[model samples]
Target: MKTYDILILGGGAAGFFTAINVAEANPRLKIAILERGKDVLTKVRISGGGRCNVTHACFDPDELVKFYPRGEKELRGPFHTFASGDTIEWFERHGVELKIEEDGRMFPVSDSSQTIIECFLEATKKCKIDVLTTQSVQSVYQGENHWKVDTNQEQFSCQKLVFATGSNPKMWELLQGLGHSIVEPVPSLFTFNIKDNRIKNLPGVSALASVNVNGTKFESAGPLLITHWGMSGPAILKLSAWGARILAQKNYQFGITVNWLHTSDAEEAEQILRDIKQNQPKKAVVSKSPFDFPNRLWESLVTASGIPSEQKWADLSKTQLQKLSTELTQSKFNVNGKSTFKEEFVTAGGIDLKEVNFKTMESKVLPNVYFSGEILNIDAITGGFNFQNAWTGAFILARSIS
Candidate 1:
């Protein structure tokens, strides 16, 4: 049996980072990364449309924790240890310069995920970390003072084992067999599938809007995009993360209320529409929408609201005007399902955070066993926050284990 000081059971961001940190911290300590997938960092290669959103620019630990829907309270301690600033510095030190966008999302200046992957590979190589591809670990066991890892290839022993296998069900089962409590996993960061023409044909059109899920409980305001299937972008993604559990409870079936104008209230938005109608009563409703919405979207919204485009605002009844106001300001759509955005899909639940020490991501129930990344019940919104959790968790565990 091959033996090492530490055995990491995944070669993604968390596994690689843990190996690099441990190796760098203790040169004599042997470390190996076992990855089941053919290619390492497959998700990283495809995340953020291949740009690899490294981290968010949010530096404050309190403010940063809010982005994570699952591990917000538990991640407070970990974020303080290694926040987004630490991530930026880590990448910068490794020869990959990252730039933050106006929306606070940080990406490599090279604008290629290869840059991040190459940097991780280079770091692993420099630290003398052994990476074995196509090695899928079937189970892990604790023996006296060491861990025995079983894989298809062979069995290995280690002083410590880190389960960085991400959100895979098999990985969770392996841990659960060893007496770890796992929070039921569910999909997060998905776009809503609304089969409505108001947003369908106007695919790429975006508007600054506020989305209120089921009138209350969850709300997010930002740039919203019209997709071929439904609505998306920052606002929708945020709503999805915050309401992930609720949506799952309802089987992804719910109604979404969109405040198109993003005004203070629906009454204010209605007043704005009323003023537009009064000023442009003679203008063709099809030709001129009350708001700055796209022409195609305006026509669709008008048609969906059952309002006649040819009818002058002066000739329209109070009921028709109220209906148009409802369609524009408080548009409600039936969300039948969910669709993944780009190549970025995240799971919301994993090993419960309470069972793991956030300071080091080490299991409180099991000694010398650590957890990190999405494998834990920690996930954030679409912006680089999720990746930041991986970095933060890995850093904490690596430091503790070393």
Candidate 2:
């Protein structure tokens, strides 16, 4: 059996990070990363639509933890130690400069994920960390003190093992056999699939809206985008992230109440309509979009209100005004399915946080076994929070092992 000091499974964001940091920390300690696929960093190449959202600009630990629906409480202390500033500085030191966007998402200034891949690849070669690809992990067992890992091609022994598999069921099963519990994994960060005429044929329409999943306590406020298939964007993505577990329990069938204007209430929306009628009485209700919504969305809303396009605001009846208010403030739509969000696939389950030590990303049930990344029950909404979790946990693990 080939023996090494440490072995990392799943050659992904966390796996490569742990390997690089550990090797750099101690030159003498041997480290190897086993990747199942022919290539490594496939997800990294495609994350953020190929730009690679490295981290969020949120420097505050408390605020950063709020983005994660799971592991928020568990990762509270971890974020304080390795927050976004630490990440920014670390990348800068490594020749990869990240720029923060207006929305606080940080990405490589070069706007290419290949920069990060090259950095990691160079780091491993410089640090003498082995990168083994096409090596599939079939089973893992703990000997008296070390781990005996069986792969498709070979078996190896390592004094320490780290798992960074993101939403991979086989890895979860392997951990389960080792006496560690695996939480039931569910999809997160998905866009809602709604078949409603109000948003149909309006693929490019978007507005500042707040969505509440009716019958559940899930609500999110942000810019919502209308697509041919359904609704998406920050608000919808946040709702999906926060309500992953609940929506899964509901079998992805639920109702969502969307406030297009994000106004206070129905009365407030009604008043806004009344003001529009009072001010722009001569203009068509569809022509004068009082809200900042796109004309397509405004026209759709007006049509859905059972009002003609040529109907002037002055000709609108009280019932039409009330119905329009309801449509703008509390438009309920049926969500029948979900679609993955552009190369970013996240899940809300993994190793139960209770069985792992968040301080070290180490498994409490196993000896010398550490974890980082999506293998754990920690996931965030959109933006760069998910990658931040992986980077934070992997950094901690590297330092702990070193």
Give all candidates' CA lDDT scores.
Answer: 0.86, 0.91
Question: Against the hidden true structure, what lDDT does model 1 obtain?
Answer: 0.86
RMSD of each: 1.6, 0.9
Error of 2 at 401 (Å): 1.1
Best by lDDT: 2
**Taking the tens digit of each residue's C-alpha lDDT, what string does model 2 give over 199-286?**
8889978899999999878899999999989999999999999999999999999999999888568899999899989988899898
Identify the candidate with maximal TM-score. Answer: 2
lDDT of 1 at 100: 86
Lowest summed lDDT across 10 adjacent residues in model 2 is found at 287-296
Q: Could you give candidate 1's per-residue lDDT for residues 74-130 as a string of tens digits?
A: 888888889999999988888999998998999999999999999999998888888
- How high is each candidate's TM-score? 0.96, 0.98
Q: Itemize residue pairs with steric clashes in candidate 2.
A: none
| RMSD (CA, angstroms), candidate 2 | 0.9
> Model 2 — TM-score against the truth?
0.98
